[model samples]
Target: MRKGRGRRAVLAVLFTAGAVLLLGPGAGAGAGGPGSVRQDGERPSFRLRTHEPHTITPDEGDSIPPLTPAFGNTGPVAAPLGVALRVTVTDARFDTIALDTIPRNCYLAKYHRTLICEFSDAVPAGAAYELAEPLPKVSGDYYAVNGSYTYSVWPLGDPPAHTEDYTAQYERGKDTAVGLKPVAMSTLKGDGESTGDGEDTGDGEGTGDGEAKGGGEAKGGGELRFVSDGYADRADWGIEGIKLRGRIGEYAEASIPEPTGAAQRVRVEVPEGTSFAPLTRQEREGLPSEIDYCTRDAEDGNIYCSNPRWYVTLRVRIDRRVEGAEGRISVAEPGNGDTNPGNNTAPIKLEVEDGPTSIDRWVPPVSGFPVEHDVPLETAGSDDLASPPEPSVISVDGRTGVILLVAGASAVTLALEAFRRIRRARNRGGRRVTP
Candidate 1:
């Protein structure tokens, strides 16, 4: 009976404490935060796979689901990328889908069809996200919404000696193609009859479309004008290990839009005493298919792609490490082809100020990554640096902290009250009370 009484008292206290803990103000918000970031023990890389666009309507009520974007990351730490998905929703039939007040974390551009949305939280590597959007009432036209997630990465230095701005002009690719002309423009003859387009020999004039001289089919011919196809979120931290000791090697990547359209060159200008170095056997094997075709130009030692392609990802790396060396790698100016000179020539620094002795081995060309889709850290702050995290570092959100404190206090008070009741019962020559 004594044991039964003790058990009853224990159960009552535990239940009361748990209730107090959960009822604390603003609870449950931290349940799915960074604490949930997964560490799958894989090399840090980004693979963004898009699903076939689907349609949602107000008829579906509050059941509009988020997109299951196949965006994965295999990095060291799990932190918010401040990543936003810019979705361009257009009315396929009338071009009148206005961007107005939207749902959770989504904002609209005043005069554009773009809707920018921030997800619930930072996603870990190898995970997928279902992005949210507002549903419309009309069903006359299907919307074609497209966009990409843009984020940044920089060096890891304590009391960071330097923080690179990495402006959009230097990082992102602008007008991909230029000088694209048409072969001929349709024109009309003096007799008021339709004639084939006027021959366009670099002169910008368009003649009317013409039917063949006598009812035969007239084929129109012209040069295809280059246009922007997709968003160039322009950033790849590269896949490789960084060893601090004898030689330090790494990769820098550029995200360009198209493969076959423009003239693009990837130049890796290393610091003095360090030219574009060699890659290991493993590194050579995992290179995207275009390595052989886009090798270093014998004339200038940079990789040039005159006959551009879609498969060759813009991955530039210096394989061999140089002891205690630091410099920046530059993607040389891509001549006339990249009309927007703004993003043509960007430089990235490869700093080894504080050394990492050994880096994790990464065998790239990871299986299951889509051929083209296969694309792709921050330092700690001063206070965090000065006072290192201790073993007993208790990290908790405000709500969680409050809940724990309340629970602890309740448990202590219950225990004291129960003990007093038991003592009074025993002194009165009766069985000790459990309450």
Candidate 2:
């Protein structure tokens, strides 16, 4: 009996030791436990993505939705490009998804349409992710509404220095073509007929249809006329001669004479097989009489004047009598206008439309500029540049709960074994107890 009791004592001690070992470490392994304390001094690096949500409304006669903003380029020099994006629609009835990465100002302009946005960042290559499902088109001419969508972006490869967030607002408009033309009485009247349908009931000599025939579709019909005596007047109107040329559309191939100091050239496009009349004597006579007033005498006795110094006022008329088509007519003299000639000198080519003809502005060849990396010496040894650790999500579900309950029961059993051991040891010397 003493040997049996000795074995019981040993069993009790073993069970108690095992219980303490299991429970002590297991309970202390939580997030804020000893291990976490050791890692507290370490910093984590991360890349972030951010963007605003957007809603768009179509104009009265437009058929397609506008271009939507997506993720732009990310990464410092020599780093791999990374991109992450998510687009989900809560309601799938009226919205359709189309992705594009055209670099215009700060927006995204719809391709082949009048919609425009101001997005001016390079998009990362090979980092596009889309989840698109078409919505049913609503019946009738009523506006179709799209359900709200949420978009989230993250770096796919490396963490970014910082994440950006933006929501977009879109507005749609009907697409229409603008016709440019030069001003002349006969040309204006002729344009009126071409631009208008056959309905000419308005004022006599007017097409009544509200359409104007722009410059009779003549080939090279509206070329600027220069005379041997030179152009008239400095500051004839509000425009500078050199600056004025930038605002007008080029329709023909023409050269400005280098020796004449003429910085501006005007040319107009005409339809195939059309010819324009030469400047009439009367029109030539109308040239400003003050032409010699702007001439400057150089040491060689040759006269010289900057093209911007001369300005003339030309009239513009639009004939809206035609029914279907519309037209514009502009006429201006060679010029330096009232404004400072040097003040308005932005690059004319830069101002020219760079994207599709339907749009008015140029998109940059590259969207986003790559990030620069030249850290200071003080920060070189810091762990702030370290990569972020992978994140693990904690979840509480039925299965987890069941496992926890089982663990708790196991722990309780361990306690009972330990208690039994202690009680038996305390009653060691006593007589046998009744069952």
RMSD of 1: 24.9
Q: What are the lDDT figures for the candidates, one per model?
A: 0.33, 0.27
Writing each residue's lDDT as its tens digit, candidate 1 over 1-435 gives: 887588667868766666556565434433321222323242232222323323334454322233222233323433344333333333211122332324434444443333333443554543433322222222222121122222111111100112111121111212111111111112211233333432211111223243211001112311111112221222321211222122223344433333222223344444332333344568769876565323454534564432235343334343333345453323332222334444544443344333422344212222221121111112334442232223344445765686687776777677677767767766787656898
Candidate 2, residues 258-370, lDDT tens digits: the string is 22222332222212111111234676577776421122123233223223333322211110112232111112333333223442222111122122221132111111211
How many steric clashes does model 2 contain?
Answer: 39
Model 1 TM-score, all chains together: 0.21
lDDT of 2 at 272: 18
